[model samples]
Target: MNFFSKETKTALQAKEAALQLAFAPVAFQATRALRNLGILKIISDAGRAGISLEDIVAQLTLSKYAVRVLLEAGLGIELLLVNDKKYTLSKMGYFIEYDELTRINMDFTQDICYRGMDHLEEALITGKPAGLRELGPWETIYPGLSLLPPDIGKSWFDFDHYYSDIAYPQVLPVVFASKPRQLLELGGNTGKWALACTGYDPDVQVTILDLPGQMGIATQKIKAAGLEHRVSFFTTDVLNENLPFPDGKFDAIWMSQFLDCFSEAQIIAILQRCMASLADGGRIYILEPFWDRQVFKSAAYCLQQTSLYFTAMANGNSQMYHSDDLIACITAAGLTVISQNDQMGMSYTLLQCVIK
Candidate 1:
């Protein structure tokens, strides 16, 4: 069942894969152009009848050459099928054009990662987010997340929230199984989870611990929700080892897609802090899309590729971790993974841990 344990392609097939990689960027841009320029929509609207390059050009007010080149590239990318000088949308094209998940991933890639990815090699060499400079003057993306251009910021948050949002409803019951009165949510971006927690249980008091900028955004949402009395904010750089977590005994500490944003050592340090802050019988829950635990190969592939984005654009020291590696971090921090539930909403793994 190990999909990647052995080579399945013939030599010629492997060579073709190599060539695809060589021109992958060109293919990506061409596909984006086809979608953005309305070519894919026109062909999709044409249904089985398909649409001709001439018709596409006429409808879009683009030059014949421009439409033709992109349509031809679309053909090469297997996103289109041409017959009798007319183009039809392939299954892949349909997904690219209309699928919500695909749309979010495409927008995220284009708006947030495409240009910054050029510095990936430098980031690997320097152990720093060299590509982050493409976005703004920040050592890491977290601090500048709120300051990103509106469109870019939208794509980033959309990408971040899409996976976690799918898992929130499922995780709520798991976290509240103990009916804990106090919950601490780390990396509480925009306060979405905080809102979910407060809404799920009116009696549960939630504290969102995050950086100031993220706290600002979350604070607004908390106030707007009129849950200001039930929800509180704690702003600090989590990586500042000197500044330990605020003095409080939290009944449950929740980190959703948060630990993966830090290096292995940082994860251990953060987990240690969580241990220190836990009340009697308190537990820590970590929800992440650990690549190694994904049920589908496609999900694993997507997670693996997302790690590159972390290297180039997020914090270079962090990645979408393997399950084993992450578990090791927990053990190293003097915690025991009492329960691990995999295949949760959208290929995520929920690890329930207790102090050792």
Candidate 2:
């Protein structure tokens, strides 16, 4: 301790500073670029056979210098190795190939996040979105999504897949254990949640309501799961439209990961509709992201902000609102929160409310 003096402490601090610089994007983008160019795909496909820089350059029409530069950068990032004349992707570079659950990291990054990031300062200044109008024409972007590069489509689908897997399993027990007979899933994407519920209890009958474009996926999955009789799909624009079911039709109404896609007024209107649709003792189970002051200052918050921005741009108006605001809305809509739990690392909350 006596030998450790102020100068040594200062030197140690400098060492720590140098280590953090290794995680910078400049240090990683080279490997990412190579993966984007299909070099990684060639290496992954070749396996023990290996590949050469000449093969990559010939296959991709990239210049030799460019290929060398990318490989060297990948080497620097530990994603590649240069053995004599050949350059091959390293084991770590194979990670994406095994990412089966998939996430929309790249699509959100390219379609919405990268551009929204450029306008973060504007969003802070106005307390409003910056890239809604600037988001590329929806008519052009959405219809062509399936035709976009495979990586892009996988990225988009992966995002939903990740959230669904992570968030839905935690909720299955709660929904089933509640012992509800008839269920209504509002804006349930592709009927994944409905299938889970019906699978858990043969007695449970579920109806899923979602956008017209998403109904096909829901119906196909529901029918394939052999729950066609118990689970059904209803295509309706929930934001600017009325509930398709009459009052007291469902024993439980599930609004998983859906209510966050609207403004406060819209959430309140939806809650009112849910109240009317519920059987007297029927409950509404809501799952949504609930933010606080700390979340407002995080990079993760930027994702939510960008999501709301793009959603409003694409669908007219959608948003992420506070849970307290929602509780208030539920109360005002004549529903009582019987129980509420926050899960999925507090990015989402589940509330079981009954008509009061």
Candidate 3:
């Protein structure tokens, strides 16, 4: 069944939804302020009895006016419930305060994507990442990733790794089941998966193909993990179709949360290259969170919103894809999906393919 086949809201509900959309930014900032200012924690600690605005103000250095304004906003945002002049954390507030995923997503949106998102309209018109100027001078964000401010870089990688890392344990067994000794990982950011693969199979030799800056970080991580000998690095821009991939056949190729970083054309080009590099009978594993394949509407909503980030900040092209669109790219690249595993971790779908 189509997840959004029918309208579920009534006229009043639809109007309220429209109002929520209009005030989304205000609610977002208010919620973030409540969490960051430790107000949510104070209310949570107060337990079932809740606490008064005066008590909340007494616990923090913020003025009563400041605390009161945010608490009122929080009430409207549904992050807090107030009764008899007391405030208590709501279920939504709990997630905002303590959920790791929520924290990571919020931080990433604030630090990396917020300012640049202002240029989204311009980027859409120009077909370029106009908002990237907020960070550094680059056509796209990839080359400047390593050079990002420490806090920004941390948020970026935290968001990137969180989704993929959760699926590693479940996917490792699937990829290693065939016992591919010569494994190649495209866009092997920070060597996380390479490390996992080497640790999983002692005899396996892995190669990481990525841009030079990412290669540096991955190289350091591999060496720090004492797996340098088992892991090799191939530093080059994978988007540059003029440059050929390393001349070698692999038993299996793995790309985790990688292909979504490219546009449809680029994905097809990269896959075609992978097709050329695949050994006879070798398999290619692609792990992605296709929005349409999501089990929940919320997951699909998040993926769809992330596409705008690509428009304004990351690159003016690539996006979190729908499954059918991605599969079309696969077929265009002359490869066929032999197996597909959904709901691996979070919202990810792992596609196991072979040359057509």
Candidate 4:
């Protein structure tokens, strides 16, 4: 199949876009300053009438000169509008200040990615997470999530939870559609999805499979939620081919925002393993943000840029995939796509597959 569609622009527009990319750092900092200095919130609170420059400086306790320069920079970035020497929040600026998705993305980019991204080139060349050294001594971020300094770990979890949590409510019903007696959750970080599964269907037994270190956290959450009996744990590297799933069969396997964390070969191995453990008529449900299936260019742009984060910080080999590419991997693993659910909450797509 041909590659999925993308928005295109003329040469002049593309040139302007290139210039914007070149100055992205300046814009990033300016946007942060607008929020940090209370400039954006102040204008947003003032409504359409806007707020005068003097009021912004006075409320923020900053020198007029500094405030003026920042406001001008904000204007250049299209985050603000100035009229009659008063400022108002632009659509982008309002979203920056208020939207949960924007806030989570901003904090994640600023706290987790900003510095590590500097080594993106080195990572791409070596095919390793070269930037991981900036945060901790680990081959990848997953193994060291618990050991990361408290603030850094919070940033990581916040970024991770924010994305999946928003989509879980909508995803829960879809996964329960088959009403399977036993459900196996792969990459069950922190046990949120497993907990949700048990909560969704009290009779359904869940076995969560992930690394031991990650299981440490997920186990705690399971116990805390009083789900220890319903939600079981299976700790494995997942890349280890020797030990796959348990002897017991699973009726439905759930992988939520998980496979994109691994390389293509790894994903295929994991799926092939699942195919071995799953009952003949069982299904595999995969929830992911496929860049090509996104409804908006901005969401797709975020997914593509997140691929760089994988290169530099998470794991070098894997990335957010387009639907066509990921489906190809599933087919290669001896699975057939039977149905799909897209636009669940935001950016997520659910693919339901069965044995080929």
Among these predictions, the greatest lDDT belongs to 1
lDDT of 1 at 72: 86
Tens digits of lDDT, candidate 4, 267-347: 999999998879768999999988887778788889999998899999899999988889999999999999888877677
Error of 2 at 52 (Å): 9.9
Off by over 4 Å in 3: none
- The order of the candidates by lDDT, greatest first, is 1, 3, 4, 2
Candidate 3, residue 72: CA error in Å? 0.4
**Candidate 3 lDDT by residue in tens digits, 1-356:** 26778999999999999999999988888888999989999999999999999999999999999999999999888999988988898899999998998999999898888899889999999989889899899998989989999999999999999998999999999999998989989998888999899888999999999998778788889889998789998877888888888775899999998998898999999999987777789999999998888888987888899898899998899899999999999999999999899969997999999988
1-356: candidate 1 lDDT, tens digit per residue: 28789989999999999999999999999998988888899999999998888888889888999998898899989999999988999999999999989888989999889999999999999999999999999999999999999999999999999998998889999999999999999999989999999889979999899998888888889899899999998888899988879675899999999999999999999999888889999999999998887788988898899999999999899999999899999999999999888867998889999988
Could you tell me how far off, in angstroms, the CA of residue 44 lies in candidate 1 after the best superposition? 0.4
Query: TM-scores across all candidates?
Result: 0.98, 0.67, 0.98, 0.93
- The regions of model 1 sitting more than 4 angstroms off are none
- Select the stronger candidate by lDDT from 1 and 2: 1
Q: What is the C-alpha lDDT of each candidate?
A: 0.91, 0.65, 0.91, 0.87
Displacement of residue 208 (Cα, Å) in model 3 is: 0.3
lDDT of 1: 0.91
**Model 4 vs. true fold: TM:** 0.93
Per-candidate Cα RMSD to the true structure, in Å, reads: 0.9, 7.2, 1.0, 2.2
